[model samples]
Target: MKNSDSGARAGALEVREEQDPLLHRLMPSPDPAARFFWMSGADGRLRIEQCDACEYLVHPPSGHCPRCGGDRCTPRPVSGRGTIHSYTVNYQQWFVGQPPYIIVIIDLDEQAGLRLTSNLLDCAPDDVFVGMRVSVRFLARHGVWYPVFVPSQAMESDSA
Candidate 1:
């Protein structure tokens, strides 16, 4: 699919607008712990928090490392490559005129336990499965970009 901004294929997925009211309601305000994450997203990169003291990569960025209690952490860019660890197809109409969507728990290849919960796009919900190789595509809404995943080229070729 053509990316709105670059007119190129947007990673492996198509970007969708953030129309879910609940999602908008729950979106965290930019703060110290997560400001870098948002900034990186705006800059078109996927960054995960890494604890300087223990080298632990933390998702859902926190102020301190859960493993070492270290407050010294920094945002680190990742490969944006991963596999579907788990997922669910939501048919409920949380937003009017929206179709069913897949919510996936992705296991990032960068580190064990380094996972992210995000939407799976550019494919039917029925096509998503555990262990499916996928890559990230950034979607922008209200000037903030969020990462969504789509089937990797290998998977697409395998299906073809």
Candidate 2:
């Protein structure tokens, strides 16, 4: 199947092997605090750290709450909606396929300072801009799933 917006093929064959050798080497084993964040994607949910005491949301999964130094943080589902806080287009041949791709820092809607760094798929690298709305889509590789963002439906319609 072809993606209507990006013209890229989609569905079951979309997930490819890690084409960047350095990225493959740098993929870390999920620590206890981050295990849920990693595994929840396989279950089709975006989970982040939520502090039980202060109600602060944390990304990158921390053992203690950065706000109140509380140890009562747990994984909670987030809306998976965000805005592109920042991004860059890479022109180097780091991965397979083409030379240019977009990497974005998403500021998740759940809380301030809750952000994730992920690739933006289903759009041209040059099309990405700060403050662009996006939503998460999961891709599996090597038995692990990751949450990547794509242009939100609103953004798609605006472009159309």
Give the TM-score comparing model 2 with the true structure, all chains together: 0.78
State the lDDT of candidate 2 residue by residue for 33-111, as single tens digits: 7878766666556788888999898877876888899998988877777899999987887556554778899999878
- The TM-score of predicted model 1 comes to 0.79
Residues 91-156 of candidate 1: C-alpha lDDT, one tens digit per residue: 888667668878899999889878999887766877888999887776666655677777887334
By lDDT, who's the top model here?
1
lDDT values for all models: 0.72, 0.70
TM for every model, in the order presented, reads 0.79, 0.78
Could you tell me the lDDT of residue 1 within candidate 2?
Answer: 26
Score candidate 1 by lDDT: 0.72
Report the Cα RMSD per candidate: 4.8, 5.9
